[model samples]
Target: MKRVALLVLPALLLAGCAAKEAEPASAGLTVTGRYPLEYAEQFTIDECAGGYSLVTIGEERYLVVPEDAPLPTGLEQDLTILQQPIENIYLVSTSVMDPIISIGALDSIALSGTQADGWYLRQAREAMENGEIAYAGRYSTPDYETILNADCGLAIENTMIYHTPEVKEQLERFGIPVLVERSSYEENPLARMEWVKLYGLLLGKKEQAEQQFAEAEQRIAPLADQPSTGKTVAFFSITSNGLATVRKGNDYVARMIEMAGGDYVFADLTDNGNNLATVNLSLENFYAGAKDADVLIYNSTIEGEVDSLAALLEKCPLLADCKAVQQGNVWCTAQSLFQQSMELPDLILDMNRVFTQENPPESELKFLTKIQ
Candidate 1:
């Protein structure tokens, strides 16, 4: 039987429409409207007549109150109230920190789930060095005292936090609300970047957030009409055991490649019901499928960058026979590309340049470096 594709409403296309008042919610307050998003599917913001916004992330709901706004009467006993002007936060999600920095709310963060050395954002690294943001331990083992002493208003964590429910429970037990950022779950690169709006809303920088998202949308405007470059590309990482880990056909990385006017070589790959975007296979199996690919892009976000065609061949000696390697058509992505959500469009443009051989000044290419 053929499968039916799911129809996901463009949370992006709905932006700027007049917000209509909806039915009265729990406290007899009607939802007046909401900040419309473009591609994001992981969360929503509904404005209420009582001057509060209801934020829903996954299955968790939060009531956001603007500074000096009165709390609505008779809210659900279990609902969390996130008063605005929030300060002293603990951020664990590395990708989330970029958007937080983009929204200019870095000062509000007092604790970090990632160590200073683990950060790729210069501002975050500098802040940690200056004692503005202290180490609060990783998600699996958070420092309770650091969080408590910092008076953490909220805990922004990644999906990995779910693996340690006790840590989340302990933070909540201490009155620190934990919000799991879900941008990584989005399958569309733009949808993932659209999370900037979510951060903007939370930090009271809605205008800046809107502008940031708009600018990124504009960056990919050419993609909406550009024809496919007809190039076949394979992107993967070599694991420690010599297995090749490649993205699923419908994964966001594959989608990004398609948007860049190229066809993903492994367009039919899937691991049934695993919910994993990537799957590992023997190097021989990978070679059988992609040996003739026109371009090979190494994902350095996982195993780090590899220099020289000879060095890559050392990792997978079989790849030395692949068409791309033989033709010297290989590239490597920057280690920080995955964490900086705003740069995915730029990455697409970089791929386009390689596929089309648009030799702009070398300085124009940001994320990808040629493998000599």
Candidate 2:
């Protein structure tokens, strides 16, 4: 793969700011080595002379500079620089919380964009209740006063931050680096989980992150050798307007279903490799595409789970005509399914079990529950 990087010129970066606009690595920069990677392709961690770690994510780049280390001279002035052992992070990206937590660096986060009650993770909720992590406001409306008071080192945001670019500008105006984590944009399910390695490096937990990712990789290794279950799955949930929100064929949901040895019934409904992972289908269209699917997995991460078959039918009466519905092969995802970003293998295993077994053990079901 082609290597693209940026320069982090300490001479040009404003004081207290960890990031700046990205520019290509100019004269006087040298590549040393890169942190080993497995499945993650969205970002890269490269080393330069004098121990400067250049992290490239798409067109943007960030350099992790060691404490008290003198800046590298002659590099481009546009790339951002983050001091090592970042602290007091104002995290607005909910998926990032899992990776940060997986490395035991939850203490490093000083503020959350999600409210106390908004978190599905117990550690996050407890952290907020115990005053360890406070709500600093949402991504669009951050509490600048609180963030400044906390001396926040970084502001981690999701793609939604793009909708409020002015807020990003304001954070930079205050010399606070705003990083938009794009793990959710990954097409591969494990690739999204692989971002844990990147967060591990940011929090100075490289070894732990590597171990976590390796273990997860090993756990799912056998899945590749498993024969296809010859079953088809339809993963979707009804939207507020009575439409079905479903994963596109190229989406991670479809990828996960395939890895679990099942076929995605809507595998041809791709978004032409765009960033969008899901597409909305009218009830009639969804039924036409998925009526004969052997399994129906209700994606409850967004709309909340239905407790029973009757509840699901009440929400979408058309499902009653589906083959999976008639055969009692319907299941609903747990509410925590999306929030458990670090548990990719476990989730894949859950899906695999559902496809291969007539009655998967209830005690072992982690991300899904069969509708009774």
Candidate 1 lDDT over residue span 42-67, tens digit each: 88888876567878788777777778
Which is the leading candidate under TM-score? 2
The list of candidate 2 runs beyond 4 A from truth reads: 1-29, 272-274
Clashes of 1: 3
Top-lDDT candidate index: 2
lDDT for each of the candidates? 0.81, 0.83
Residue 165 deviation, candidate 1, in Å? 0.9
Provide C-alpha RMSD values for all models, in order: 7.7, 5.6
Please report the TM-score between candidate 2 and the true structure: 0.92
10 residues in a row with least lDDT, candidate 2? 1-10
Residue 119 displacement (Å), model 2: 1.3
